[model samples]
Target: MTQKEPAGSVAAVAGDKSSLLTMDFREKSWIKVQKKDGSVIAEYIGKPGEQRQLEINEPVTIIVGFAPGVTMAFRGNPVDLAPNTVNSVARISLK
Candidate 1:
């Protein structure tokens, strides 16, 4: 017979498991990451055409301030952000 793990016993592991998110800032803008409790985890101001890389964790939120010409990509996938508006990327849970 095969053994089965206990219920709720398998803990979530974050061991070297991360996704690369690259932001190509075409204009000046503020980028930040927050938790569910409204706590800021990471924040920064990106320059024009600046390339930024972030190793993202699970169950977090990403907030981007209004800025035109700013674009983002996760795992080489383009992320669409509205212009001149506050954008929030939430519920980013990675297994």
Candidate 2:
């Protein structure tokens, strides 16, 4: 018979399991947001010179909606996007 592991015991044994979870949303390597032309937008990290790889026809979440208007959201967190801008996807890097 197989013995059940205690609660969180497995995670305890794993080294720096905190890396698996982060409170820093800025560290996320992905961007999901709508575009200026009303097209869905998605991008993946790309080569040094190449533009981010875009995924067409994918539904993107509106970061502006997270707060209020585009202006407000940007003003609230310029890190997310430029102030007064609408429907744009920006890649955030953490290094």
Best by lDDT: 1
- For every model shown, what is its TM-score relative to the native structure? 0.63, 0.20
Name the regions of candidate 2 deviating beyond 4 angstroms: 1-43, 62-81, 84-95
Q: What are the per-residue Cα lDDT tens digits for candidate 1 across 1-53?
A: 95554685333333432356777888787887776677876888888978887
Model 2: per-residue Cα lDDT at residue 4: 65
Best of the candidates, TM-score: 1
Give lDDT: candidate 1, residue 40.
Answer: 79
Clashing pairs in 2: none
Q: What is the lDDT of residue 81 in candidate 1?
A: 60
Q: By summed lDDT, which 10 consecutive residues of candidate 1 come out lowest? A: 86-95
- The lDDT values for all models are 0.61, 0.31
